[model samples]
Target chain A: MIDKINKISDVEWELKEGFMPNMSVPARIYISELLAQTLEEGAATQLANVATLPGILKYSLAMPDVHWGYGFPIGGVAGFDADTGIISPGGVGFDINCGVRLITTPVKASSNEMPKIKRLITELFHTVPTGVGTHAEKKLNEKELDDIMNEGAGWMVNNGYGNPHDLIRCEDNGCMKGADTAFVSKKAIARGIPQCGTLGSGNHFLEVQKTAEIMDEEAAAKFGVEKDNLCIMIHCGSRGLGHQVCTDHLKEIEAATKKYGINIPDNQLACAPIKSDEGKAYFGAMAACANYAWANRQMITHMVREVFCKIYGTEYDELKLVYDVCHNVAKFEEYEIDGRRKKVCVHRKGATRSFGPNSPDLPGDLVSVGQPVLIPGSMGTPSYLLKGTAAAMEKTFGSTCHGSGRVFSRTKAKEGMSGQEIKEDLEKRGIFVKATSNKVIAEEAPDAYKSSSEVVRVVHDAGISLKVARFEPLGVIKG
Target chain B: MSFEELDHTADYLFRCRGRSPEELFSESARAMFSIMFENNDANNVGNNGTDNGTDSGSNNCSNNGSNADSDAVRVKKEIEVESDSLSNLLIDFLSELLFVAEVDCLVLSGVKPKITGNSLKAEVFGEPFVPEKHGGGTEIKGISRSGVEIEEISEDDGIYYQAEIIFDV
Candidate 1:
């Protein structure tokens, strides 16, 4: 599979349409020669498989962090013609709208704050529910769950969990339209209610970081990030609710795939035409799961703020939300394709939108600047904050890599360092860690993933997104 | 009759084999539970102090003493899933088990599955998760149907069933 991919540029590779049978278009991958060494043949095959999906426009794309996932590669992106395209749950993933949100603090990082960092992480661990089978302090009733499914993060704001301004900072204004409670299942609701404010396990975390370097000072200023200042990054999703929704819908979509006779290389890619009843029902339910995820993050942000205020005498308003971007989701957006502006249903799995400057989807204050693309690193590694670039619009449908994709499996990562050993190593490096289990720490060791610095660089060089600032972890709380 | 781990880039992949389809399905459940929890064989640990006790430093089940109840309360849940194919039946059955584990907060073991054509019926047994004892391992977010192969192999000794399953963690 790797042999078939022809290098198009220093940061771009292409697998022509003929590389695989029935491929509607070529597969485009953004990766540097250095990063390409780690690329797996299975991931390349999956990208080719995505190209064979119906109504795929131009090319099936893979970001620098691409890896083999269920149906779509983890860092894969594909857009289908809205009128004739298909809607797939596998494309969106089980953890619908699993995303990242960054919050900037006015205070700067200092060596004296080590004790304070420890206290903050401890408080966060106790206040925010984490790990497997952990539930929130407050259980949502049926009516409340319905509202959350419809309103997204805005529901949290309405309930006094967050400020109204936070809504504007999120993609789609913290909510996706067409979300109906009628479409969501009781199993999903039951799974969601108890896990509303939770930070579920497996690669989900809340990190306290300090901006280490400012690459584009102007962009960094616009994003409310300053050199040496502390910030909080939250990574989570809709939890059990989203998982159940995808599980429930996949069965229906699988039946629909057979009914529609849509040929797919992988059963996980089972889909239905966008206009079909099964498709519409999935969109409604998916949007509701996306809303639930946004609400989950908003609630987490509120709790983080309370911890900050309790420790530093800071006000709730002091910590500002930089931006929130979904990593796993599908949304309708218009893009100029083949010189014709067309609406397409873009499915981004383990990827984020990199809408360039002047894109209408951005908030008013950010119109002059591009969208803030948050790229979180693996445990104990540096993360980058990048701004979307105009070149992304013409090439990759304004999408970019989400994070440092995994290079080692969970079992593989455990071979070297035990979670306790990794924790001690991080503490020695001035990065404090708190987690529900040592298993998570060991499994999420930095060695398990690719370098975030390298992943962001390939995209930046490819003009998908440009670096604004870099952050180093001061402390982390993992589920 | 046993399951072994396989390496994948981002998730958990394992292969299990048994003397029959029922054993194969049961072994798959055990394999999945083994991935989700660090100490799945809780009965081996003799102490009952695992019920959310003050032992915060370690998640090991105490094996020194065996109390009358062993502090671990066992519960049972039954599920029936029907599909057109045996593969779908396995996916549906495992998906149901995953849902019950998360929503009901049970770490299941001792699965007894009965299969008739494309339908599956199973009774699952486990204790409610005690974070103090059964250390939560990596969470298995979703069960993937990709590369799922259930096969029956004929050997001189007898016929055996085997399957390869991938999980999204």
Candidate 2:
């Protein structure tokens, strides 16, 4: 049951304390009435549960793309007191630090590039491993795994996987601290060892797109995304390693829940006080997973560049990383609460941080234009690259929606569509697609999700995150 | 019980129907776990004990006893899973059951599961007290409803449940 909701504006709704039992503060949702009504009852109910978490301050928030997830609803945002709040694996999701990275190419959008696009996608599918239990061609030994976990994308840059400039454009510079490899379990290490650079199945993809619209001139200039410019977007994460970490921590946190005398509505919400031993262990393990994901993306970026070099006979420098952002993560960031500046652990399960311009965290070159926000739409639809705004900081805790939220379940998606049929449809529309499995294609079909353009419209109008450019898909390679 | 094989895109579909969802969950668990090992002989490990050496089967049962319900005579669970492929669907369903046993302190028994393809139907009998007739070692968490759903195929109007579950890591 929920109550005390107040309409703050046309697009923003507030959930006051009396709305739920044990709630510590109010909650804010950035969405229009049309989008709100489409939300599943489970999403709102679970969001209420998130607000009850300990050490919560300001609000438990949901982006317009909010959908039901494990514990915290996907697209949900909540910040907890670093010293007193709890850390839950459910908040980070199974694919730790799963995110999107965009790279602009020298190529342009045109029907003439169809054959070349097909060749590039085929090369990518051959180079990148996909599906369940898929192992990479290059396996990591124990010491190498530890190094990759510690150094993150920096390790890749040092090892010739990517350039140093790529890291500068990534969120958190492509690494987070406190990832102690010692906290990771033997099973986790084993599962991750052979899967360092593989793209695991389900929703993960590598797509070639071309900018179709430029909405913000200033931000687009900073991001190097202009109309008709070709770009590559890689969507993946730590793979088996991240899944194992969540599995290992869920058991540990369940025990810690009893030890700490913490009460939660769902066992999936297992957690411990942030400063406690269990919490520290999970955080360390989670960081390692995050690093692994960054390294994986870096390796894939190298592959994408290789494909482009082979197709266009151009140098690697021709393709550059515009920005990479992690959507599923927990970060210790500084935010003002009660007029006091404090460190808070911000958990964004399926949400992205949309820090406004001039924030200290932005790269020096991007400081004047705000952080670049990458919102990948469903397969075959248009994806957006947005810029953060000052309004986002005041309204959505400097956060915005990640992508087109799921409207139909995977089962429903598969039932109504066939992968072959979907592939043919996209092909007819001049989009090339290479997938590891037909089932994955069906489950991620464009119709099974909300329109990304509509979702972006709500956020842009709401002033949470403003649109910079929209890219239409030209080709996609899915795992 | 009735069983049907429906197409689930890349994987074949298996659907089972019982009088109740409890029967569906139990039968589904058994059918799914059977894929992990070569045989369905539950008693083969009875005298052999756990080969993992982490804990004896009896000790595990004892540890689980404290968490059993005191007043309730029994609880029952039903499970289903949908995945893009057969292998992932199997792992997801079994892992989910393992999570429930380890975290929620629920002991599952009388599992009679049936798997047709990607669709798994199982019924599980859960009770607060450890069943004296059977020894315990494995547990199942509730299936994740995140992407779990039933879809109707227009080709034949066949209904299949697609779902996944997380187990104790």
Candidate 3:
């Protein structure tokens, strides 16, 4: 796979038309030499396979953190023409809008605060519902579920889970337009209802941290982040509901693929024209799931605040959302393709939007500094806070790397180490961890993933986003 | 029927083989269950660390034979699902199994599957996934169509069916 593609620039590699017979356009991957060394042949082949999709704009692009996913690479980003192009569920991963939200607190770090941080993480573990087959304290009826799918963070705020300003800090005001409850399957609804306000197992986590260093003082101030300031990061998405939606829609689109006579290399890459009934229906369901994810994260944020309040008697409002970004999602946006601007459907799986300065998607305070890009590192590592750059807007469809992509398989990671040992190691580093099970701790050990700083540097050096500050975990609550 | 782990850059990959197609599917389900819970069968009573080939950390919490506890090993569960083809039949079967694991906290065991027309009927014997009674490993989020392969291959044991599946762990 590495031999099939050639380096086009210092950070970009090209897979020409001849690389795949059915490819509709050339493919490009943005990675440094070290990343390319570990890039799997199957992953590169998957990226090339995405190029075969009809109406794919520019190049089927993969970010520095790219890895083999279902149909597209995990960090893959692609845009399709709105009128003639197709929409594929494979382009958007199963965890619809599995995203991250960063919140800043007035609390500061100190030697005496270590016990408090440990106590806070322990409290968070019990406060937030987690693990497989887990249910939230609140169960919703059909109407309430619909309200959540429709109103998203707005509903949460109005219902008293969050403040109104939290909406502006979210993408699309925390509710993507065009969500239709009717498009959501009954099974999806059944799965989603009980799983709301949860941080599902497998890599989802809530972390308490402090800014360790500042890379850009002005940019960090604009985002309300500085050294020694306490912060929280929540990583989760539309739990069972989104998984069911993807399963249902993937089957639907597979049938539609045959009906539409669109040939694809993989079954998971099933799709239909954007205007087609199947395509429109999938989009509607996906949007609802995305909204559900935002609401889920918001609820988790509310729970996090409750933990802080119980621990320190601080007001919930004292913790403010810096930004919430959807890593796996598809949105209709206007981008300049070639010389003319066109409206297209952009699909980002395991990737985050890094909209540059002056972009309307940013909040008022962040508009001048570019959108806040939150990148969570692996367990017991330093996560970076970055700002979107104009170069990102010009090159990556306003997208950047999401997280440190995994290097070791879950099974491999678990086989090599004991969860108890991992927890002990993390605690030794002054990072307390509370998890549903030790196996998760072992599976998510820092060594199981690539260096997040390296992945960030690839994108930052490539000029997609620039580092603003660094956050080191003080405590973590893992599901 | 037997299963073994295959190395993937990310997620869990399993290779299962059996004398026939039905056996293959059942073994596949067992492989998936073992990945979730070290004790795929109640009779084994959490035969922990050795089951995963490598140490699965199951000695941490094996089992006690008692019916009164919610953690008591379950007897059995019957499941039935249909799809257009065998590949989808496998996906549907595993998906329903995952649903039970996520929503019901059942650890599947004694999987028996039969193909009828385009659909599949399966019976799963499982126990409540008691953290106090069972060793918990990686939680599988979902099964994927990516890199899924079902083939008939011959070995010294005679003609057997084999499957390669990837899970979103």
Candidate 4:
């Protein structure tokens, strides 16, 4: 399968338009020669299939961490012409705005901070509900749920869960515009209401980390990273709400695909024209899910802050949100398509938007340094902090890899280690872990995923996103 | 007749087979719930190494057994759904069950699905998730339509249905 594609460069491969029939554009995959060896043929085909979508501009792109997903590859990124292109739930994924955020603290790590770290993680594990069927500490009513969908993280601030500064540090001010609650189904609301502040299971975790290394000293300082300083990272999404939204809209859009005569290569890629009624409704509902995710993360951050305050006897303000980036979800942004700037629907599935410095999309404080790209590794792996580069804008629609892509299946991982055994191994490595079950730990074993440093190296050398700092886990809480 | 886990890199994929579509659907549900509760046994209480407000290390709270305490709390729910095709009906049925599993905190079993034309009706049995009794199960995010397959293969002696499903976790 790899022989069917053309290697454009040391870090890039191209599958031309005719690789799959009806492909309107070519698929470009970014990976180092080393990482390319691990690339699945199915993922490469999925990328080519995405290129078949109508109104796809320039290229259908995949990052170094690309892996086979349902329809689009996990690290897929593509932009569609707003007036003539299409919107697809498969491209955004079921967990809308499933993303990550980094919280920096002035407290530096010490040689013997394990006891304190354990206490903090234990408290967070209890305080923040994890695992299946776990609800928030407080159940929200329909009215509050709507407010969260409409207002995003600001709803948390108004309810005293967060502050104004937290909002600005988030992408798109923690809320996507045009989120209409009317477009969101009641079933979706019911699923979301109880899970407003939860860290749901499967690949979602909260980790206490310390800066292990810093490469871009200036950029690291600007992002509030100090070598050896304690930082908390939270990875999760909109919980059940986002899942329901995707499920509900996919049915509608599937019908719309038939009505509009849109021929899709895969059922999951069923989509509607960007201007159609179904398309508009999906975007509105999807944005609402995205807001819920932002609100969910904000609440989790608040809980992390409370945990720190209790442990260190410090103020809540001591833990500051460095930045938050969405790995899934579609956004309407202007980019130079042909010669002039035009608005296109940019869909990022398991991919991070790596907006370069000086772009107006970034927050004012981040304008000089570029957006913070948090690439979380699997359990016990080293994660890197990277900054978006200008080359990303010129080539890959300002997007980059999300994390170390999985190489082994969960079954294979579990076959090698039990959750208890994995926990003991990490503990021996000086990383404390609190998880809902031993099964998830086994499935998420570090060996199950590709090397984080290798994936980062590919993107860094490809000039999509450059490495800024590296973090090693001190303690992790998973559900 | 039963379900088995299939290899998928990112999510849960399973292949289930039965003599008919109804059995295939039921087996599919069983497959999903089995994978979910793979690590969990009723005896594994207080599994998170933290005080989860539940009693720890008590064998009496096992929800899967004939214990009167757990049997008395068993909840039976009736599910009715319709779709455009059998394949879609399968997705809808499993998805509705998943919703119940998450929203109502039920570990469902005994999925007796009755399919007629592109519609399905079923009665399922489960009990409220008692952290002390059920411990932990994999939280499936949603059921995906990708790579979904439902086919009837004929043998020399009999005909059986086979289905493939992938769950986003």
DockQ of 1: 0.41
- Judged by lDDT relative to the true structure, which candidate is superior, 2 or 3? 3
> Across residues A298-378, which tens digit of lDDT does each residue of candidate 3 receive?
998998998898897889999989889999999998888789989889999899999999986787888899998989999
The TM-scores that each candidate's chain B achieves against the reference are 0.84, 0.36, 0.80, 0.79
Across A1-479, the per-residue lDDT of candidate 2 in tens digits comes to: 12335788877788777676887787888777777766776777678888888898788998888887788888899889998899988888877999999999877777598998988888777777654324566778989999999989999899889898999998989888889888888767876777777665566788999999898887788888778988999888887678767866876787898899998877667789999999999999999999999999998898779878988787898898999999989888887777888888989988998999887679999998899999999999999999988887765667899988888665578678787789999999989987755556776899977888888998999988888999999999876
TM-scores of the models, in the order given: 0.96, 0.78, 0.94, 0.95
Q: TM-score, chain A, per candidate? A: 0.99, 0.97, 0.98, 0.99
Ranking by lDDT: 1, 4, 3, 2
Q: Which stretches of candidate 3 lie over 4 Å from their true place?
A: A1-4, B38-40, B44-75
Interface root-mean-square deviation, candidate 1: 5.0
Task: Report how far residue A309 has shifted in candidate 1, in Å.
Answer: 1.1
**Residues A262-299 of candidate 1: C-alpha lDDT, one tens digit per residue:** 99988888999999999999999999999999999999
* Best candidate (score: lDDT): 1
Determine the C-alpha RMSD for candidate 4 after optimal superposition of all C-alphas.
3.5
> CA shift at B9, candidate 2, in angstroms?
18
Predicted candidate 4 versus true structure: per-residue lDDT over A1-479, tens digit per residue: 56777999888989998988999999999987787777898898889999999889999999988998978889999999988999999999999999999998989899999999989888888888887767887789999999999999999988999889888888898989999889999889879988888888889998999999999999998888999999999999998999999999999999999999999989889899999999999999999999999999999999889989989887898788888999998999888767989888999999998989997668787899998899998888888899998888889888999999898799899899778888989999999988877777888999999899999898998999999999999999887
Docking class of 2: incorrect
lDDT, candidates in the order shown: 0.87, 0.73, 0.83, 0.86
